[model samples]
Target: MSPWNWSDLHLRDPWWLTAWLVVGYLGLRALRRRPGAAVFYSEVSLLRLLPRTAAQRVGRLLPWLRVLALALVVLALSRPRAGQEEFRIRRQGIAILMCLDRSGSMETPMSLGDTQMTRLDAVRHAFRLFVTGGGPLGGRPDDLLGLVTFTGYAEARCPLTLDHHALLELLDGVQVARRPPGLGGPLRPASPSGLTAGGGGELPEASIPSDPYWAEERLTAIGDAIVAAVDRLKDAPAKSRVIILFSDGEQTAGVVTPAEAAQAAKNLGIRIYTIGIEPNQATLREIAEITGGRAFTAADPQALQDVYREIDQLEKNPTEGRLYTQYRELYGYALWPAVGLIVLELVLSSTRFRTLP
Candidate 1:
């Protein structure tokens, strides 16, 4: 909620107010210094003989009444106005696309106090804290969330939607696996041990391979992931769109380079915030500069979580909001009061208040 006003009621026009004071001073001087000349000499005894009634009292007050009327008229002429305005904000929930690197490199184990957790695991924890728990920091729950996962290729795991629970569910299901076969026979099994000849006796349960392809895949197509997220948000409503890219300092395979993808997002009016888990300053700088967003290097899970929380803070409260206001002087007739004061002064001098010659 916000408020605006055109003219502040508390503010006064110094120039006009000064003029009023000057007029009052002049009136006082004329009454005190030339009281004999300003009023015609007459006898109050004549009025006392004529009548003793309410009219005589009313007549006596005319001079003071005129002075008060003149003061009010001066006040009105100053163009005093009190204005108030209010805003009716339509809360347009934000549209956010979270691009996560799912390359095998993301599996590197990092120490969590005495315990060790993979990069992917730490990200999941932070992500959970952001969604179901609250903002990765303390962001509002009403913001829309989307998801993108990339390894050798990029995939839109979730579209822009307000269903954060569903989005988190999709994120939780993410896992590092070999890139799907590219225009070839059925995806090659992750291991040869999984293949066995069918036998009259059911082949011994395909023995699990001892070597589970622990080496991180050689490709991380971060650029493609950003491009995909941007494309998905193209048709979104005219609200601020943001992309939070989480990666471990690598981009080996993609049709577009990271710079090109950042340009595309910039052209589409989307802000990209890059969070690099790796300690590569050069790479982090490039990503941050290209996307016109800040670069954050997280050496550990706590830092990583903090980065996400900061982004949430930025999201909930935008830098600026709409404003509109108007101001008008209600009425302007200060001269009327001055005129009334003159009339009262005249009547008082001609009647009961007149002095004896």
Candidate 2:
């Protein structure tokens, strides 16, 4: 059998201890009393004459036995319990606000085997993996999630909520461009595939360069997005709040700088984790360092998935402690048993072991 463990074992009332002490003192006094001359006996003769029955033997020991049994009954009344009662514990879960760059640059087609997939497509795939229970992200149904998207201007796509299904659906519905034209940049064509001609000459496939005119509108507003996300989570009640920013490292449009936004988050006790979809280590490192968070570079879909998985682990296993408490009440008809034991002792003493005159 397994050993029993109890959270609480001490007596709740110190008066009960004093009462037990008094009872013990009285018992000792009773045992030490001298018999009167009228009740005195040369006991061997009388004891031999008595019937050798089990009831008689029990009667002889009844006084001390009754006292011991009463003590046990009183101790039971003190209500010893092996475990604590159930309580409603409030275990605070992590709050995460995902800030994704939806600038026109995200539409650039990256190769996936023979096919092509946009950066946005890769990001959405990673997000889907994160929201579904327990792979890399370790996201539980209980964790609160929020969403933000940024192009020229940052906007809250969804508020903080524990509704995972709704959040996933919202994420799926997010398209490349939700705002009007000329906001971020014009979509560029796929990169050309280099080929060798019959005469050893290089043949370049048709390709379109990203529009350079909207440099400010298309790339620079990431700081604004971070600031907006931080503002949204400022009054949140969770024990730990986090911001996961996904960007392509080109920042050209917002009023605030990434460093300033990171300072704002630090002031509000929010940690930021920046994931750069392209190979931009310098930008990623700056964002990570400024906000005291981690930076990950995802050059491919699998690497992006790994980054999200790491975020999930960080969320599930936070660096905080928790305390818990419990209580219980027990009730029964104790009066009857106490009275019955007293009466039984009295009857056995008078009838079964009565003294002769």
Candidate 3:
């Protein structure tokens, strides 16, 4: 319920208020006639001289009580709500589409503090922190974020939205791409010993191919990922549009070359910040350069988290929007009163105001 003021009060179903006309008509008709006048009295001058009893005086109120009850019922039918508050919000926000590589090569183990996890798992953890805010990252509260996963093909896992919780849920479900059973190669680990450390330790720089079947599983479609991101980010309404390309391998499968996709992104005023999980950064550096963005190589889990935090700082825009809370339902305020009045009317009509047929 709200104070009876125009600014705070809102009628949800105003059409129901039209029922008041019927109640009003009934009230006027009730006022015109005596309600319990079933028998006529003739030659009764002596009866008029007698003092009226308490029951007869109080009985006059029954018709009005019923009318009041009906009026309350009509009021209840017209649902009422109250506004809490409203304000204008101004924030520096950006739209970011994170392009993640899910190829089998991403199964390479990496160190995260005292625990060991797959490269994809490390990236997922960093991304969750980046969106929700933890440690050094302030989180993207006002920014629109999306997701794109790629192996041999690129797929948009989530659309650009302010709902980061839903985006993170989809991100959690992403797994390394797997080939069919009859495929020539198995998902062999890139490094059996796991060449990564947490506190700025030396990371594996060279792509040492120990398994002959490695090439069959490592189908990273970097170009297709960029193109997919561009398609999703081009029409964003934010002041700044960005794509974070996170991958451990070069472009091994795709129709469009990485250079062409970068050029397309540049034409559409979209920046692509490339982060290489592996040390080979030639293609990533070129892609960043073509789109007037930056590239970084994350040797370990900490480095990957740092890269995302830096990107959050680099892309900033001042955005204006209105914030309004949903209205509070006030129907119960009217509805309960209407029910009470109805019960009271029934009890009085049945006892003190009882009439003959």
For each of the candidates, the C-alpha root-mean-square deviation to the true structure, in angstroms, is 11.6, 10.1, 9.0
- In model 1, the worst 10-residue window by lDDT is 188-197
User: Which of 1 and 3 is the better model by TM-score?
Assistant: 3
Q: What TM-score against the true fold does each predicted structure earn? A: 0.53, 0.56, 0.58
Q: Candidate 2 — which residues are off by over 4 angstroms? A: 1-77, 80-92, 108-118, 140-143, 178-220, 313-316, 319-330, 333-357
Model 2 C-alpha lDDT per residue in residues 1-357, reported as the tens digit of each score: 233355454434434444567568757765776445555566668766877888656655666656655665565566644435444545467788989887666777776567578888888878877876555454555668899988767889889888878887888777764334543433332211222213333433222223443323444467799899998888887878899999884555668878888889988889999998666547657777887889888887778888888887777734334454343322123334656777887887677676655
Which candidate number maximizes lDDT?
A: 3
For candidate 3, write residues 262-334 as lDDT tens digits: 9999999999999996666699999999999999999789898988889878876576788776687778887
The candidate that wins on TM-score is 3
Q: Candidate 1, residues 18-131: lDDT per residue as tens digits? A: 666766885676456533454555765575477567865665465566667767676776777655554545456778888898876677888778878989888888877876
**Which lDDT value does model 2 have at 131?**
73
State each candidate's clash count. 4, 8, 0
For model 3, what is the C-alpha lDDT against the true structure? 0.82
